[model samples]
Target: MNEENTFETHRPRLFGLSYRLLGSRSDAEDVVQDAWLRWQQADHASIRDPEAWLVTAATRLGIDRLRAARVQRGRYVGPWLPEPAEIDEAPGPDHHAERAEQVSLAFLAVLERLGPEERAAYLLKEAFDYEYAQIAPLLGQSEANCRQMVHRARERVQAARPRFEVEPERHRKLLERFMHAASRGDQTAITALLREDARLVSDGGGKALAVIRPLLGRERIARLFWAAYRRRDPAIEWRMGMVNGEPAILRYRTGKLAAVMVATTDGERIVELLNVANPDKLGAGVTPDPGRASW
Candidate 1:
């Protein structure tokens, strides 16, 4: 295959790497596009490994974008969420379960605590299965330094990662019950399904109405959901689907997508709820219309 075809072959992995590092589909796309441009301009004849060259280029671009994004996110209103994306269930034979889990909102949230280089090193080693030797030059560090970055990032991510259910069916059932309870303003039932320390976070990007800070406690979360549904337009609809490899509730207002919600549970009860209401972030993974759905 030619250079264009070769780049096309690696686009998915390139996008995946950038997305995991940056946690924003648009930003990831920008990084991948930038990598493609660089690839076009580079003398491919001298490159022994096109994939490695592309991976290094994309990884560096992601690190720079993420650094800039951290600054902007600091000024963002409310909790910032990774833009949710529709996962392709069959992403070819190269897809790894570990990589799939890394795309989760819960996992991505943990990654936010990591610095740019640390995040890239950790992902390259863990998610992409790159060796320390391979990851060293990718981040412009020594192999030992890359290993240290991955080690530090791993500790932080593991400590902060929420314990979400691994079974998809059980997760879906739990969400269904929560949705049913919230739809009817059944705060008692809602509270019953939550862990005592359950937290609700929304990303409104200051463009939509959302809780400025994380709402904690089962009681508070229950009440917030109860009040939120009660105040919403009667015509708005809830559609259940999978997002970022987990079950999600997609809200629609007048047939337009409004928000996407996904909960992280410990099999028995939900420990965290993430709602993304930012319009700009909604365009990536979710379908605009998923037909009518009910709890």
Candidate 2:
């Protein structure tokens, strides 16, 4: 295969690695593009493993972007959620639950607590199933050091990540109920569908109206949604779809995209609601489908 063909074959996995590392689609794209540039100038005949070389380049670029993003995120306006990706419909029965768990917005949020290189090491080993020996050279660290990074990062992620119901049908059903309740301003119904300690985070990035802090507690969240629905604009439309390999609500204003919401549920009740409202983060991998109106 030609260099371009080889790169194209590995592009999806490359983007997946970068996106998981940086938690931003645009940044991931930049990393992939930069890797492409490096690939174009490299001597392919001397490169025995094209995938390994490209993965190493993307990982390093992602690490650099993550370092810069950490500083920028420190000054961000409100809660920062990962940019939601538009994934295809859920796969068949043979699909692994781990794939969805690894890419969920909730998992990405947990990953934010780790340092850049640590995050890369952990993701490569755990999410992408790369061996520590393979990951050590990619991050320019010793194998033992890479193992430590994965261990520490794993502990932090496991402790902080929200519990998500893995069954797609069950998760979708619960989200449907919540959205319907929210649409009707049914505070009682909404409250019933939430865990007592449920948290709702909206990332508007100061470009739209959003709560400056996370709304805690099911009751408070219920009231907030009630108030929001009371002020709902006639032009606003909502659709139910899958984002980040999970069920989500896509909010559109005047036929333009506004926000994407995904709920993390603990089987029966929602444990967290991640609403990405920042305009800059909405359109990367998704487009509005005119046929599937949920509201």
Candidate 3:
């Protein structure tokens, strides 16, 4: 293969690396573009192991962006949420799309609770399966320290997470059932499918109607959603879709995107709901119309 094909081959991994590190679709794409540009400018023959180099470059770029985002978030109103994107369940998926795809909103929301170093360590070591020694220099820490950081971050993230599979298709099925129950305003139906203490969190940035504090308990969540349906007087257009890889709903009315709801299941029951409803955050350009959805 030529130089173009060689670099093209590594694009997917680079995107995955950036998306995990930053948890934003647009930011990941930008990092990938930066890596691609750097590649275009470099002497291809001099570089060995293109994928490794690109991964390193993308990770570093994402880290830098994450730092800027930390500062920018302070100015954010209500809540801050990463941009959302759609994923197609069909074959021949693009690598960049796949990269943004895996960093689910549920996963990204978890990342928010972590410090940058911990987030980086977690993504690199856990998702990429990078060795401590390999990730050490990337984080500017000793190998031992990197290992500990990864271990600690993993514990926190895992603890915060509801035990679940990341399989997109199966996840989509569970979400469909969730939407159906929610739409019917069937509290018992919803509660029966939810964990006893399931949490529902929404990021409306205070621009939309969502529970500012996370709603806990199956009963409370069912009531809150039911209340919302009764309160909403406007006609809405929506459907099941994929956001950040897992099953979600893309809802809107007229022209503006109203909310993106993600459902997390613990195999037996739905455990969490993350609703992105912030209008300022709505400025982000994300596509979910062609989701990994089956109607």
lDDT computed for candidate 3? 0.72
The runs of at least 3 residues in candidate 1 whose Cα sits more than 4 Å from the true structure, single-residue gaps closed, are 87-99, 162-165, 288-295
Query: What TM-score does candidate 1 get on C-alpha atoms?
Result: 0.92
The candidates, ranked best first by TM-score, are 2, 1, 3
- The 10-residue segment of model 2 with minimum total lDDT is 88-97
The best candidate in terms of lDDT: 2
Candidate 1 C-alpha lDDT tens digits along 1-295? 8989999999999999999999899999999999999999999999999999999999988988998999999899888999876733223334333326788877788899999999999999999999988988777899989988888998888788745545777777899798888877789999999999998999999898899999999999888878977886787777666678667777777766778888888889998898889999876665433233521
Residue 97 error for model 1, in Å?
A: 11
For residue 236, give model 1's deviation from the true position in Å. 1.7
Candidate 1 C-alpha error for residue 41, in Å = 0.4
Ranking by lDDT: 2, 1, 3
Against the unseen true structure, what C-alpha lDDT does each candidate score? 0.83, 0.86, 0.72
For model 3, residues 129-242, the per-residue Cα lDDT tens digits are 898888887778999888888788878888887456545565666777878777767787888888898988777765687666777899999887677667664666566655
Q: Which model, 2 or 3, shows the larger lDDT? A: 2
> Distance (Å) between predicted and true CA of 285, model 2?
1.1
